[model samples]
Target: MKRSYGFLLTAMAFTLVTLVPVGDLPAQQATASSAALPFKWEELTAPNFIKAVELSGGTCIIPLGVIEKHGPHLPLGTDLIDVRAVVLRAAQTEYSIIFPEYYFSQIFEAKHQPGTIAYGERLIWDMLQNTCDEISRNGIKKIILVSGHGGNNSFLPFFCQAQLASRKDYAVYLFQPPNDPAFEAEVARMRKSKMEQHAGEGETSAILAVRPDLAHQEVATTQSGEDLKRLESMKGVYTGIWWYASFPNHYAGEGRYGSREIGEKELNHQAEQLVKVIREVKADKTVLELQKQFYDESAQPLKTRQ
Candidate 1:
């Protein structure tokens, strides 16, 4: 009988990670139990880290965000800040190791704007793949990728699909929260601005909830958030330049009506939705089992049933 190398490495990592003295940990996290260990990966001492792996049931989350210009009013790190807030709140209820401030992601559409850190296409692909692999190496077998930037919608799915290109001991799950009608109705009833998207009313409200100082509501209306109708006749067509053609300033929606109250509602909804996902992922076993089956068949398809 052959022993598996992956298992051996995982066991060794777990052993070493549990050796740190509890006294060496920060005062806030020093006496905390498995249930109380800090959710942020960097905040956990080695001993607590192992406990976290157990507490999370080998589950973790990468709250993905991007460094890009968010209109003229919001800070460049708006996406990163907002996403972190949501994931941190969710983790409090669900108990998963949360990766810190991951802003390296697809953002070519905002390259023309200031403070956009758009890594090369290949680098972005390799970086994300390597990050997931590293997470698995550290004993986390389930990874949840939750992105706050809307631009990553397409890129994340493609990345998840590519996991099948090789046999992986762990599984990657993307968190795509749906629009709850009740939540939407509540927002709509209070929303004064009809055109909020990026730095618009909704986004500004979210920021206000997280970092009210960073959201300059008064400056939000300095620039136009309305679409300029640059590609009207080519409605059915799609092109890379479509976003820039319409909203070159990268501003969308009116932010003047943003309120901390509205922001609180949106954040609560997002965090609640993510908590549900964390629970589901922790209980999921079929995905990894199916993945293993697929990998085994792919290795020798002739032996598989016809």
Candidate 2:
């Protein structure tokens, strides 16, 4: 299934090249700040949404997150809030119609903890399918999904791949923040702790930047966020209960190292990458056409033999 879907995406990649405009770069707006973006989908008037779609070239972003616990300091909706914040900033810079808060994602690991609203597997699949259908119905040709939750690492890819179960008029693109050694170095140098995963230094710093008032820096040490090493046998081999075994509290890492400076740097880098993807998606041409061709060919596979 992965291979077939990968092939479809590959085919779309080739097709998108032909459909999208590619050439000279435009003179960027030098003075514009990300603060200029429309904060909510409903904020745009009916007339403005039309203009928004045109400006975005029918491309839209769905910043995915989940409503779950983020250690002891961060908010339950931390991932949703932060992901949407970055998407909003990116859309402001690049002009894509942003979908509002989307917190429906995989979080079965956190179900035991408070405020963890993990949907069932069937519901998760249907929710995503309906979301894509609804977006396409709304005239968005390309949908970019950027997830802020690590728990969705598997689900998001599976969701994207399933788009090819049958052909559709639109496309789905999922991305993680691009790798940048310089950014990594910057984050490391800015960090006060060595291992900051989950509700730790990095997440804390990010929340500090976006919403500092919400950060409980002093109370971060109230709970031990370290791995209890409870599931010692599961380390060598993976299991479904690994997360529960290590951190039953659903908290990992210390938030003491969080700072606004690091948050700003990381977020800025993420927004920049999102903006770049927007530009590339806008210029892309082949995805739709190839999807059509592939759909046509799939009806008669015997004729596709070499």
Candidate 3:
């Protein structure tokens, strides 16, 4: 049998979009589980790592984020900090090996701002590839990238697709934040205000839930953080400058409208969805089987008569 990289890409993307949460665990089984099962890849002892790998079904999540200025009130590591908390909590529920703090991601868009750590393009790509290679070497076959930074939206998908550049023993997956009818209803019920963008109500509320001490809701109004109308005409067409033109401060939306309750709801909901994905990936056999077949077929294209 032959395999193609396309099969791997599709499998990786499929692993993300379809999430199904399982309900409850037996008391004895839950009690027998190890605490290190949730996170800190380094913390898992050599012996325990075997168990962790099996528990996660060879699936691990690399919660990718970036360190950048997030307005006057929010911490510079807002994205990293928030996503880690959610990933850890999710792992607790579904049991997946959680990679440590990895803030190396695409953040060139925020380079003009202070406290932004943007790695060289080559380094970012290498870091990810090496990380995956190392993980695969360690026996994990499925990797999920749960990205929190808005800037990483394009970078992540592109990275996942590029995995097709060569044949690999492992697959990469990325989960979109969940969107359920009940969950959407919950968000509407919890939101106290609607802010525009950076450090806005939604983001602020999220930080408040995960790290209240760092959240300075009182100073949220210190900066306008509003649309400056620098390039209103650019709306019809999307350009890299659109963000900078509209939000010069790199901050938009209203922070005062954010509340811890809303943050908790968003974070918890995301965690719940993540739990479902972890479970599914653990039992997934179709992707691996299809990938093998495609790879085998690709090697003998001449024999594949149409």
Candidate 4:
């Protein structure tokens, strides 16, 4: 069955509203203080929302998260919390209207685990499409999607491509920032454990930086996250059960060595990357124009030049 997050999104918007200026950035930061505006959708007043649209250049961000079990030690909403933290921080600096918490994405692999909310696949698609459409109707044309869960990596791209199925007014940009080589080297030096994909060292450390009280480093060693190697002989094959086959516990790495220092580094890195994305998206006009051109040609492909 399909579920709607309309009520939840509205409630989240209210919780996020804050008193801030929502106007264009001046040539100098000194002038920005007087003209600055709140960058959250729920925070903006009806009047201020108009200013925000101008200030943001019609740009808005939806930080996608998922509710799933991380491990016995970490919170179930680990990905959602961490990803939202980064996007919120970035919005403060770059000034884009931040959407509320959105956790609708692919997580069927973790359905067996407690606290996992896996919606039907079709529902995920329609909800995202309607979300973007509604955002456009509200006047924001560029919708940036910053996903917190790795499981969404596959679904998000396909959703973006499906936009071509029909003409739309807005452009959807997925935030897939590339890791800095220097930063990766620095993390390698600071990291205590090599495996940090799931609720492992790196992920746990990031949570500690964002919400230390929720990160239970002591209980991190309660479960083993080692791969069971059940499908070693079928290495070339790709299957939906590959994740469960390897780590039925749904954990991927060691979290016992998570540290706040590493967490700070990782969190700051992601925030910085997102900050860049917001600034770039705000300045972008080519994408929408190109999209319009493509849609026009797509409508009359028979007339398109060879």
Cand. 3 TM to true fold: 0.84
TM-score of 1: 0.88
User: lDDT of each model, Cα atoms only?
Assistant: 0.81, 0.75, 0.76, 0.81
The RMSD of every model to the true structure, in order and in angstroms, is: 10.9, 10.2, 10.2, 6.0
What is the C-alpha lDDT profile of model 3 across 1-306, one tens digit per residue? 222333224322432221223345334334435333425687778887876676566788999888887877898998887888788778756767888889999877788998989998889999999999999999999999998888888888999888766677888888875558987777877676555567788788888777677788778888878887888865577777777887877788888888878887888888888878876776678776777666667778677658
lDDT of 4 by residue, 1-306 (tens): 222433235335543444244344444322333464666677779987877776666788998889998887898898888887777767766777888778898999999999899999999998999999999998999999999899998999999998888999999999989868999998999888877679999888877777777877787888888888888889677999988988889898998888878887887788889988887787788998999999999999998899
Clash-forming residue pairs, model 1: 195-253
- lDDT score of residue 69 within candidate 2: 87
| Per-model TM-score on C-alpha atoms | 0.88, 0.85, 0.84, 0.89
Q: Write the per-residue lDDT of candidate 1 for residues 1-306, one digit (tens) a residue.
A: 222343224322332222222332334333333344667788789997887887776888999888898888888988878888788777756667899779888889888988889999899899889998999999999999999998887899999999999999999999988878987988999999877668888888887777776777777778888888888889677898888888888888888888889987888789899989987887788999999999999999999999
Model 4 regions more than 4 Å off: 1-33
What is residue 20's positional error in candidate 4, in angstroms?
A: 11
Candidate that would win on TM-score: 4
**Candidate 3: misplaced stretches above 4 Å?**
1-38, 235-237
